[model samples]
Target chain A: MKTQNIPKATIKRLAVYIQVLTGLKRDGVEVISSEKLARACSVNPSQIRKDLAYFGEFGVRGVGYYVHELISSIKQSLGVDRVWGCALVGVGNLGRALLRHKEFALRGFSIRAAFDCDPYKIGEVVSGLEVVCTRQFKARVEELGLEIGIITTPPERAQRAANYLVDGGIKGIVNFAQARIDVPKNVPVEYVDFTHHFYSVAFNISSME
Target chain B: MKTQNIPKATIKRLAVYIQVLTGLKRDGVEVISSEKLARACSVNPSQIRKDLAYFGEFGVRGVGYYVHELISSIKQSLGVDRVWGCALVGVGNLGRALLRHKEFALRGFSIRAAFDCDPYKIGEVVSGLEVVCTRQFKARVEELGLEIGIITTPPERAQRAANYLVDGGIKGIVNFAQARIDVPKNVPVEYVDFTHHFYSVAFNISSME
Candidate 1:
């Protein structure tokens, strides 16, 4: 189910809504109103209703949303309900940290393997998972049947990692490198830069001033 | 100068605009119109003009904007000219990776020191900088005369990390912690989450589908 024509901001918030729904379910909450859900997420009430309206009605007119049902529905809407196996190409600090993070599995994405270039770190058990050397990453990913790869290599190594992931038949990538890599248009790449975090800090500081 | 209620999406785009402006300056462009800027960023031309209007008119009535001047102004507006000395806490995977990154330095932010409880990491240098032990973190931070703290600690350890930074006299915090923490009202805390990146990825995938 493709949803275009909506603002990217709205799409991002929908994911936040799903996270809120997850919290509600864990609390054994059965029903949640737009007001309650918005408050829990530190957002406006009408915004929650407005965003949900884009995907058709998941909320009852008076009863609000059925927590578990909404969680399942949002999962389907996000296309994250299906089991996803991902490969991580950099076993450096960021790569290893992401692997040890159990939250991804809790959120429906499982990392099947990790790769690195450092001979010392290579073959070392990192975050409870053995690190495979970068030399064999292509074959290891192929053997594991991973369709999505995460690129957490250093900026200098980011492009090379992307090329290897592409050659491995991975269709999607989440790049954490500061370096921007050129990839074919058909293959989607998402970049997550914590450097943006510093900008936001400055933004808030400027706003205060 | 305070931005007059720009959309968060537009503020984000402003960050991109600043980057592109730097590229244009390097290429020796004197002036550029909205259309060319849009083409470079893959955005709609009218949207760029509209986003710019929230602030005072930077472009002449017909001549577009002066590249070098615009870059200088945006940098000032973004607080990029000021050096923000930061303490890096929780030298886990994400922390270690960030220590090696130079983007923050390029943007005028420095990780003066890093902290972690892991005895193995505390006394060692990971990226040409020593990782300070968490036990002595507060004292070391004051010793360096730093006020900005980067919290790259885990979800469970996030609050405690903030507490330490607060006691350490940090006035600004760029937090990568998944969980929120309470700092004094005067202290500006900017939170960046990996899960939020996941939401953007999920959003992009859903829209593509």
Candidate 2:
């Protein structure tokens, strides 16, 4: 499959679909119609069918989709069928929360190593992963064969962290820091900005008034 | 402004622009051109102009935008010009991290109250806010006049937390739990699913390989 041709929005919905399907599979839901799946995901039924059609037909014409089968297919398409080792930089409260986040492991991503520059935090063990110096980031990431880097450092240190991650041969980055760090075009970076959601919610609430 | 007519993507972009503008303002950037702002935001200059046009004309054709003025205009349009009091349910690690997050307060949203069903955490104070019992949710929210509810509870408890928030008269919700929660149509809910980012990065990396 040439993923480059797939719409970014479709990829996002595919991820959401996988999350919904995983939950349904856990609850013993074997089959789900497009309407039911759409309702679960807060999307239009036709939109779900359209998004799924991008990859290939995964649903029966009239019956529906098998939850387990759909999950496997989507996971395979998203390349999350196997574990991807990841390195986490900055061991502050947010980073610590992410370290203990079970969803990442459930989704086949592992935070194998942690890095920090603070002397007090450098030797500490967090969520069972020892905090290593940021100066050793490139070497440690290479040693652990980590593919992705998660940046949770303060805004001021985010760029430096990204530089280290890039130097460490990270293929992708999930940045939680508020800073916008520059990276090569080859490395895909996803920003998890909490304020975005807050602003949306605030706007919606204020609009109601 | 009847925000209803604005594109959702525009609203999201506006949030991103605010983040970038805030950083620039902190660094004492007084004015920025459309092209320069677009480069900083990783967006097209025309797209920025279009999004801002939805609200009003803020940028000078030749002189560019005054950083401070643009931030104020966007914030006012997004209804984040004033502080929004919010209640956070589920004082777990993720919830605690959110409480310590400075971005929310920086962007005019305050987590004024925290709630948990756990007896051990009920009386605990996290990030200076005392964790209250879920049983007291409605009363505390009413007393504090919190307009937004942030759910960081475990998946199983998310719906209950949302229900409590809704019953407490919350106008909006930000759900971090890996569950698709049900809320009234009038109440908006945003999902902060970390797995979505992981899946996208995993797919992009796989495509590269």
Candidate 3:
């Protein structure tokens, strides 16, 4: 539970490690050495060992880690073992896609409600959840006990949506919009920036040439 | 330019720094000290200095960095100063959202082609690009000289889509699927995994509680 000093990079790596471990578990792999796991994740073996060391030891002295055990441990450490209720704002194309996205449900995060500012989008059902107006965002979020807020609105509307989430007392935010929104320090925000990945891909491809 | 030995983390940070710098430039800010830039990016000032050091010196001795100059230099170093042609596979909701996403075009990535296996999706125009069959992926990629292949297909179809992209001679891949895929060593792949962010957010929220 000593999360205060853990590096953000370490947390992100733990997520990746759990993902790879889940895949290994699916393949019926019982145990995996840090070296093998590192290779699978495209990370340095020493880095993998160091990252896991933040949460205490996991791997055996010689054999390495039990795939299932490591997956469960990491999932528990990341607080993803139980489902988290989430509310999503903006019912645009991107928002609709996120609503229909199966990965969120599969990964223990559930979109319990959807919200939109457009009068036309209001009352429209997407992915089994009826879209509500932003006016109801805070009340609905509080009523549903939604802990996470996902912003998928356009750049101009992102801040307003973020304010609504903040007013709703959302614990964490996942911003898919291209704009930066201000929120209190207590409410952690994670950006799902597609352009960053595009830039990285472009950099690597350009480097090769 | 010396591209070898630059850490992947540095590359990702560089992308973020550029985004922050772009925002500053938009606000009409001309020069910014490393400390200010780091604060905006939520990165260490020394880390920002070190990341920029990989490319070469940019800031003056005591005046900090010229925002426009630094932005251009970073973009040049990242190889994003010029536009890169890209292809998107799978015309699903996510794929359509990506097609309509304006950030990619703004960041110099152009989705020149789209592919899908579904007969209904094929021939349909979404975001100005007509959907094509997977059978035509390789040929269209080669003909259009697309360097980046974006896999937005279902997890089950991701690997096959990757195979087609590789066969078509893609330089890099942006995999939006939840599936881990295999591509040639030369073709660097970046994952846009939403679950990773969700897990991180969940962990932070749980820790605060």
Quick one: best TM-score, which candidate?
Answer: 2
Error of 3 at A181 (Å): 2.4
- Model 3 clash tally, residue pairs: 0
Q: Candidate 2 lDDT, tens digit per residue, A148-174?
A: 999999999999999999987899999
Docking class of 3: medium
lDDT string for model 3 (A146-190, tens) is 999999998779899999999988999999887778899999999
Pairs with steric clashes in candidate 3: none
Q: For residue B150, what is the lDDT in candidate 2? A: 93
For every candidate, the chain B TM-score is: 0.85, 0.97, 0.96
Using lDDT, give the best candidate's number. 2
Question: How do all models score by TM-score?
Answer: 0.80, 0.98, 0.92
Q: Which ranges in model 2 have alpha carbons more than 4 Å from their true place?
A: none
Candidate 1 lands at a TM-score of 0.80
C-alpha lDDT of residue B171 in model 3: 90
